[model samples]
Target: MISQNTINTVFETARVEEVIGDFVNLKRAGSNFKGLSPFSDERSPSFMVSPAKGIWKDFSTGKGGNSVKFLMEHSQFTYPEAIRYLARKYNIEIEETEQTDAEKAITDVRESMYLVSEFAKDYFHRTLINSEEGKAIGLSYFKERGFTNETIKKFDLGYSPETWDALTKEALGKGYKLEFLESTGLTIPREDRPFDRFKGRVMFPIQSMSGRVLGFGGRILTNDKKAAKYLNSPESDIYHKSKVLYGIYQAKQSIAKQNNCYLVEGYTDVIQFNQAGIENVVASSGTALTPDQIRLINRLTRNITVLFDGDAAGLRASIRGIDLILEEGMNVRVCGFPDGEDPDSFARKNSHDELVAYLEENSKDFIQFKASLLMKDAKNDPIKKADLIRDMVTSISKIPDRIQREVYTQECARIMDISEQVLVSTLAQLIQKDLTEANKKQKQEQKPFEVLRNQNPKNTGYSGGDPDDPRTGPPDGYMEEPGYPQQQQAEKVDILYRLERKVIEILLLYGDKTEEFEDVFLKSNDEGEVVMVSEKKQYKVHQRIYLSLQEDEVELSNNLFRDIFTDIIGFYHQNEKFSLEQYLMRLEPDFAQEVTDILMEDERLALHDWEGQNIFTKGKHETIAQYVSETVMSMRWFLVGKIIEELKSSIQPENSDNTELLSMVMDYSKLVNSFSKKLGRVMSRYH
Candidate 1:
């Protein structure tokens, strides 16, 4: 168990901007930072981070929270893991109570899978480095491939022994369940016996972006014609190859820092390029590109350069992935090596500078590269030439942004020696066809409407319970039951938000401000009725504000106002003078999220140029914090007046003069009048 002190230290020491900035590319927008939403496909910046508040809000998805919540949402890390990650990043030593063996045995399935995979990685590495067979076969193969010891260890390269049951027996003997081994595809189970899945093969552990070992890719050294040369772990709860790219964990920082990614085909390609000093490179491990993988890269960089071999198959694969890349609104450049040379061979044969220069000089935009490469083959054949134009148009049409599509179309027309009008017309047709197919698929997959009865009139009409009922509500649809009137609710929310802002502002900006106020005390009348009386005591303005509210029966209308009022009452009862910094620091995460939302949300007023209107914006009253406080007090008094009216309507004439009720009403009325006068004074001062 982690102690409270450790949690506090983690929260205090972990800088939110630094933590979120690792995964998101944030640009300064006013006082805050804005970035494209990592939770959704967005072109414009909608994800906002407030460093002052230590929180972030995704307006598009409505997911807002502190730094810990962001990690949980973005990286899928458990709470403990998130805390540990932050601790590691901040260099905080964790103090945790040791867990018993029995407690550790009851681990979650996903975490258990992770543990098993990690064990396999360690086992494989030991086999490669320490075992004679592994040294002779796997280590030799890696050395021949020009992989340094540091690179091999960094990538966690390993090898499984030649004996079939060596790994299976060892794992089973260690109390690691055979079922998990089979499920992770690390062991092959038969009727009589079980064997190691990647026997006699060198292992390349594949990891997720967060650096958790998800799966493995094994390469065979022997010439076994019956067996495939390379085999990979099957998809499981933790390992989805389509959604993962090898070397992403190592390349994420460089990719973000450089704002570009270099994509290649195999593990060796990634190693060679990184060893050649190109750090922002990842490999697909020879699989067809997937959208999930593209999005993973998209989160880090807006541009990608695909490094392909000069072979025909590599060219075909590159072309297939171009449309996917374009559809994601990413800029793509293609670079093909010399004939019979892959990225692995080319990088090894050339120096770092030579490879860097070659890439810089040879990289071409997708459309230009495709047109130049394919135009020669379709020179004389009219049908083949027409097909080539259509294919290019099809790729252009896949682009989601219209401006980008149009730009690509113009570039293609110029490169193909074709008329711009013809190319534009063809692109239009292709777009229409794509949209038609998309709409058809959407319609086919859409659920049939069964007419569920509308339960919430505030959201939807049909309050009679039948959705098909024509007479359920007005044609314009069910409006919110006018909860306290739209103008009143807006005013109330504005006032409460303003008041809280004022309190926070005063606390933050002028925490030591001292002013004397007449202390109001609650005294009991003869008939057990409460009466308010002002005493000549020089209390601070902040203290007087709370005492006046507590001594009088001011009914709060806004929920937030009522809550804050209750909290202040409790705080005043416990402490002589509340610590504003401690209050903010000790607020629960949920309350903090709320406070941040209220502070950052629109207050529905424009005062940026108000000073030019001959209005002398005075000290305190002119500030946003003072304005908020006045607004909250006004709303609270208004609600108090309404509640008094409701009570009066319910009272009988005989009870009108009752001392208890009359005194209560009188005290409340005084409080309401006091707030009204304060609000008026603040507004008049601002004007």
Candidate 2:
């Protein structure tokens, strides 16, 4: 366990923007920063970070939390791991008690696999530099491939010995379990014995975005026709090939800085490009490009330049991936190397500046590249030329932005020497066909749910069981008031939920601020006439809310809100001062996240450049007292209405003596009316 002092120090010292900026491309949005959500695929920016509060929220996915929580959500780090990462980043020394073997055994499977993979990465690297076989075979192969020792060490390149069981035995003797090794695809298990999966191969350790080793790729140096030349770790808990891009861990920052990524085809391609001073390159590792991989790059950039080898067939197959990228609302360009040369070979042969110049000078928009590449194959054949034109139109249609689609369509028309009218008609037909198919698919998916709705008792107007029992009187769908649908009742519930959330928001924002408040009550005046009287009193915002709610016997209906309310009140009572960072660090992650969401919900308004439009907004602190009093009063009114609802539900129409329940309803109604008058608002929803 990390000491409380170290955790507190980290919380105070580590800036949220500084930590998250490493992964997200955040730009200034007024007082806050805004960026595209890393958790979802979004073209427009919806993720906001509040540096004042040390929190971030993604409106796209509704995930929000402090700096530590962001790491946990984005990188799948456990709480302790997140803390350690922050500790390392901030250079805070972690004070800890050593864990026992029993405690170590309780570590989860995914974490165990991570540990095993890291161990293998270290073991292989050690062998490559220190062992005779590794130096002669693996190290020599890497050196021949023009990899310097620093480059080898930087990427954690390594070697596995020729003996199948060498790594397995070494790991086992070091007290690492076979279960984790096999789970990570490092060891292949058998009844008689287990052996290393990458024996006799040079290793390339694949890392997560946060730089944890998740798996490895290995290359065979010798000519063994029966054995595959390149092998990757099979899909494991921590590594899914389609979702994992080679060099993403290294390239994410560069991709964000350059605002473009270089998509390549293999691990060596990524490494060579990086060596050639292009750090924004990632590879699909030869698998077909997947949306998840594209999304990973999309988080950092909106532009991708796919580098391809000269093979005509490979180029054609890769064009399909360009359509996927276009569908994601990203700009894409393509650059193909000279015949008989791949990215790795071309990058190796050129100086850094030369390689970069070749890419910049040769790269073309997807439409231009597609048209020029296919026009040769369609020479003078009218049928082939029409097919090629339609293919280009199909790729163009995948762009989500309408303006972009129109622009690309014009470009396609010019490239194909076709009439703009003909292309537009074909594009319209393709779009309509896609829309129709999508609607058809949606209806098919909802067919079973539609049957379920038809079969429902409420839909059939048959209210279930014991109809004579007043407890089960009319169905909830049958309303007492005329012209008010059941949906309004749902809307009322939403209103209450919003009010409850508002109370939480107020407490979180101003719990410690002292303010003047009006204490109102009904009292008998001099002539024995009842009149409203108010007294000026000063109280902390949280104390006022706590006392008011307690006096009315109102309890928060939502479990999360109630828990948070109790904790905040107790924290205020116990401490002389409140620290937002300390309070966040003290709560469990989920509770802290809920608090952050509530506190930062209105921060999105700042992103609209409202001040630039001369539409000024009031800061919360300026009206804390009014805000707190109104929220509490609204909550009281909502709760009173709920009480009226319960009383009405309890009245037995079948029985004659329902006087007490009806009188109780009238009393609550009077209270509601008084609250409505005091609030200077009518309960229109109730009517």
Candidate 3:
């Protein structure tokens, strides 16, 4: 395990902006930096990095965190992986606690498995290059397939000996455990004896995106009728076939740099394509296309071109993958090689320049490719053409972008010689059906949460107390108060969100800075008129915000915001000596991002030097109790207004609390009447 002290050193030395900048291009935006969100497709910049807070936030996807969190989210790195990445970037020496034998044996299953896989990879590569039998069979097979000697070692190509126990005995002698060997699927255990799984096969080491050997893909050289041609590593903790793409480790950089990915169908296809000068290519490793695989590529580039042989079988595979790509909002293109040539054979046959030219010239959008592929079968048949149009519309509907759908629909209509209106209407029907089913699925999944909330109404949405929405009441309530819709109940929760969130933001950012504020006291006069009295008070921002929330007995409705506010307040309460950097370092990646977002919101404004404009912007040290009180009162007014709405909708207005709420709403109205919109209560009955 990594020592906590080492983790702390890494955190302290590493600047979040510096670490994230390696992956994203960020420009100065106020006191912080802003960039396009790497996690989503957006035109304007929404990803913010707060150097002061040591965190970042992607407003687009609601993802935020420190350097470690960004690495984990972007690269799918585990916590340890993320920490190690940051440590390496910052040049911090990783100091790990030594593990005892018992400690090591207990749960280092994954680590041990990784080590064994690495050892096996080296063993197979050596056997293929050095062993006489392996040289004659395995090495020759790779050479015959047009792979250079450099390519062989680059991909860690190897051979498992024909002898069943060769790998097993070698691994055992090398101090590797038999359990990990079997779990990695390197060794198959039977009742009689344990033996190597890929015996007599040429090995292809399959790697994770981090370039670690996760498993192997082996191809049998023998022509035994019953034996399978290819054998892949079984599903294990480290190797999930559906989630792993062959050559991704080598191709990810090129894919991101070129802004395009060339997806093929086999290990040889990927390797040959790479050798032929196309570095940004990944193979499906012979598995059927999966969404997880598509998502893996989506992280690197939004454009994908599937290269298939000009054959019916290859065309089918391309069609199957196209829908998935479009569903992810990716720009997908399809290219078919000359007849009787797959990616491997085609690349081997053509020169590098020729191969590149062919791909560029032939690549077409999936819609055009699919239309052509199906049109051959639909020729001269009116019924078949109609089915083809429907089929094309169905594929178009899978696209999430409305504009893309409309363009494709128009294209499909022109190609099929049908009315664009007909295709559009058909698409609408399909989309509606899809949405209905998706809603049903969501409701089914939410059934448990719904049940829990029903039992605990206080914690759930204020469904029973408030109107369906601020502007609209239920039909029963509408009948009772005809003007209710016109009155609009007046809940500007955005104003509340801004005010409440501002209080928390001030508390977190300026917790240590002392500020004086005008405090308001509410009282009734001798004549029964409400009166407001003000006095100046001084306190830290954190203390003031905490006290205000406590006095009001109010909590934020947004779960993430509420959780962060609670944690920040609690931290300040416990650790009187608040260190912003130290506190930020202790926060989890996701929550830390929230704190950063709050602290860094509109930081560009602060960073832009507004003092030069003769309009002073409040700094952390600025004393503005009046400003703080305005924020607190706005939130208080919003809550009071919400309660008044509840009271107006209450069945028993004559009840003391309901009657009391009416009088309180009226009293609050006098204070807000001038600047705010009209506010009133609903009568108990129409009469």
Which sequence of candidate numbers ranks them by lDDT, best first? 2, 3, 1
Give RMSD (Å) of candidate 2 vs. truth: 6.1
Which candidate, 1 or 2, has the higher TM-score?
2
In terms of lDDT, the poorest run of 10 residues in model 1 is 602-611
Residues 1-687 of candidate 1: C-alpha lDDT, one tens digit per residue: 666678778888877778888888777665677777789886666677877667777766767777788888887777788888888989999989887889676767776777788889999999999999999999999999999999989888999999988888888888888888888899988999988889999999998777788999999989999888889999998889998999998898899898999999998899889988998999998799998888888878889999999999999999999999988888999999999999999999999999999999999999988888788889889998889988999888888888988888889988888999999998888889888999998877653432332333233322443332223422221233334553344443444445444454343333334544444446888999977666655544445455444544554444654565556456556766555434544566655555544444421011122334554435553453344345446545555666666666656677356676666677677766566555564321111
What is the Cα-based lDDT of residue 417 in candidate 2? Answer: 85
Against the unseen true structure, what C-alpha lDDT does each candidate score?
A: 0.75, 0.86, 0.78
Clashes of each: 6, 0, 3
Question: After superposing candidate 1, which stretches have Cα over 4 Å from the reference?
Answer: 2-5, 100-106, 173-175, 435-450, 453-458, 461-625, 653-674, 681-687
Write model 2 residue lDDT over 629-662, tens digit each, in one string: 8888888888888888888888786847989998
Give me the overall lDDT of model 1: 0.75
Q: In model 1, state the lDDT of residue 570.
A: 64
Steric clash pairs (candidate 2): none
**TM-score-based ranking, best first?**
2, 1, 3
